[model samples]
Target: MAITAPIATINDHSVRILAWNQIGSWLTYTDANGNSAIKYQFWDGGTDANSGFIWNDAGSGQLAANTTLEINAADLSQVWVRGGAAGGSETMWVRAFDGSDWGSWDSFTLTTIPNSRPVATISDHMVKFDQWTRVSNWLSYSDGDGEAATRYQFWDGGTATTSGYIWNDGGSGQLAANTTLEVAASEINNIWIRGGSAAGSETMWVRAFDGHDWGNWDSFTLTSQPNLAPVATIGDQSMHVGGWARASNWLSYSDPDGDAATQYQFWDGGSAGTSAYIWSDVAGGPQAAGTAITVAANDVSKIWIHGGSATGTDTMYVRAYDGQAWSAWDSFIVTSQNTSPVATIEDHSVHVNQWVRASNWLSSSDPDGDAITQYQFWDGGTAADSGFIWNDAGSGQQAASTAVTVAASDVSKIWLHGGAATGAETMYVRAFDGYTWSAWDSFNFTTVTNTAPVANIADHALHVNEWARVSNWLSSADAEGDTITRYQLWDGGTAGNSGYVWSDVGTGQQPASTVLEVAASDVPQIWFRGGSATGTETMYVRAFDGIDWSSWDSFTLTTTA
Candidate 1:
């Protein structure tokens, strides 16, 4: 009897089988003559199987299937299964036997599901200029078929195939452009990216592969931030009047990008503007306001500022430029400190009890150009009790450690009186500006001795009726070159004797007292008259120099009838 063709039924016919998965089918038909089915055979391709006959699941030989047989896709190899007859539509032949010859091979259709491409997505990211950043968290992929992504590609620009790099798990370096690179499942999360030298928005394309096909190219924007401006800070500065302050010592700068200051600007006041003055030299000579000074980054320490003419505090504003942008203005306090006046005194020589002029011994100068208003003197140096200073008019004397207000014109009138003791003597002096006093300056001098003058006179003869000039014998001299100021003539050794000295005027001989005083020019006009007895009369004469008097001199006058 003829066995009817065995009919084949699949457990889930509508469902498509994934590649490399096994599919099972069952036969439900009865033989026409009621024969029991015993054996089965399967073939690939068509019902009339030829060289494409189905092999055993172990790939050993032809397969003899029972009512149900598991078609092992693993045996077909992924290539044959994936390359189905018509775009994944595969055909298989199956037949059943009823203890007799096998029925005609039945054809059934099987479909190999295509692998779903992993969807690659990338989110926008931000990066600093010239910095390397990671792109793992910014990239993502998904596959509907539960497949893991195995490879990834990156491109600098929007296009993927033009020029791109692939991640190399071996760290041997990036693969060639558009080159597919295999990676471990864990390595897919460690992608890295870097931006170019320029700072701006950048676009790139990325894709992932799940062993089968590459996903669509995903684009992401890389925003590179611009270079940051430098920050500037300034510290307070202190300098003496007429001194200089360097900007580099007080002004400092820093940048987040490590950029150096390339240019600098300076202002005189607390704010930046061109209204005030800023000197460039120590002398406070050349000056400018709110101007930019060109300088090398490494030479910023050379910038200098002048502490102006006056003593007090001043403010200065400054800023720096870093190729990209200028930093904010910073300020520093410039303290112009006061400078004390310098005092000086010169050594002098004077006689004992002589008066010395302040102008010849004391002087001072102030660096800040302040006036020297007052002077104070004290006994100092090798010898104490050197001298004493007098008030403005020399009317009153002042002791040591006293301040005297002597005007410039009165400097010559203010006297320093020499002490009673004679020898090398010293006195200290100091000058005072309007604000401060200078250190003590020493004044040194030597006291000398003075000598008296000498008087020379001769005895004269006089006639009773005839006048005799007695002044012709009078003469005087001094050892110190002092002029003879006055002269005294007497008769009885002292001024108490009777009248014997006389002066002859144009009218007649005037009877003068025993003592006679005359100026130095009148000494030649004196006339002496003898007494009535007239034998030997004595006259005493003396001369006076400006500082000391000469000893007494004697002269005798005689009268003849």
Candidate 2:
């Protein structure tokens, strides 16, 4: 193991030196341009002066092309350039001369201007707010000596820090000339500026220590201009109110700053821009204008608006907000709408012979405060077959035929003629909305409990071999105008009356009568044949009204055989 001392040469001149390590041998000198040039030379084994090593192939006299230099040769190296340009610095490399061998060349820089600091210029001083963009060619530099690179420190609220480049430097604020910078959307709201040499006219300061001398520490304000306000536009619209007319209608919009709409407002019905029509924010229900809408730069914003409930020649105004500001109101007009009238009919039940009439019947209502022009009534049932006729038939109020005209909001007395039948009857009616008829509504009326026909027969006397003959022998009268459907004749005591048992069939008695009508003269001949029994006989007769039978009427008759 042998330890060898190193030797070096520069400008082809040998300067007296001592114990130099082969790995590290450096020197510094001022060039004609006043720029500091540093060179490094190395050797594997050598001694001062009489050592066995010389720089650059010995007789070549200068450093080789591939020779290298170390800017910071110390094991721990910290470097900062200064004074090259206002707000700017530069780095350079030179050939290193070595005895019989050329070392690799490296670069270093000067950070000192005799009496001036670097100046900076930003390309975009005023940015449109609520938008994100890159500041290309944003910060430029101009130094009195020369320009190398610019290091920037950004501040949002106040002055930049004097300690280190902080804020949004994109990790490292030390950047080359004409480099682009990016600003976030959230950061461009109020204040933003770059601090460095050559950034702007604002006086920025820097400190550069060249081993012994320290540079000036002065603060320079970077160039800063307030951002412009975002631009927005809302489109006009027109439509009707309520029902199908008020659905899916929207107003168009746009914003230049690519802002999202956070609020929407509109007027109900009034002159545009007058504020006479109350302005209301659209949140939900009929007034909700939708949510989370965005527009691109110089592009249209397709924002939708719900017209809500409005009618007549309504003048409406609309505006949109992009979280920062509200756009001007856009105007539109809406036409009036017509509403349909509603029709209704009530249900009822009554005894037979009580006819359904106009007094208690159908009714109608109009929604648009308009009059129900007319009411049309219809009756359909089996009652029509059996002499059932509406009293309004002659007045053109017949079922399925006529419309009752009215000058008011409601029309009543629409019904069917409840016939003598023992059952239900149905009628339908509808109201006209001036333009069209409403949906038909139906009602049911029942006719029940018909009065049975009365059976009257006078007493009679006859011989066993003879039959009695009398005109108007049995007569029926019904209160409900019901005709006798059948006659029942029984020859016995009254049934369930006074302990007189009356049976449909008995000894020496004729069969009961099934005839709806019997000739007035021979009613007894049909019930008894030649007076078959020889004793006082009792006979009972009753009438049916198609629905039910009347109470039996008894007549006593003396008979001889």
TM-score of each: 0.36, 0.31
Per-residue accuracy of model 1 over 235-291 as CA lDDT, tens digit each: 887776566666777777898878778877766662223122355433334445544
1-561, model 2: which lDDT tens digit per residue?
Answer: 332222222222222112112222333432233322233433212212222222332233322233332333332122211122122223334343222233444343322223334444444233232222333334444544343323432332223332112234345343332233333323322222333322223333323322222334334334433232333333344432333332123446567656666665555554333121221223223321222233332222222333234344555555667765777766665444456678887876656555555546556677766566776666655444321325443353353433444433333333355456568767666777665577888777676766667886787666655644332366778887865666666656322211121222232343333222443333444544334455565767787766668898988766655
- Which candidate comes out best when scored by TM-score? 1
lDDT (0-100) at residue 541 of candidate 2? 76
Cα lDDT computed for each candidate against the true fold: 0.61, 0.43
- In candidate 1, where is summed lDDT lowest over 10 consecutive residues? 78-87
Error of 1 at 371 (Å): 5.6
TM-score of 2: 0.31
Query: Residue 488 deviation, candidate 2, in Å?
Result: 10
Report the error of model 1 at residue 187, Å: 66
Clashing pairs in 1: none
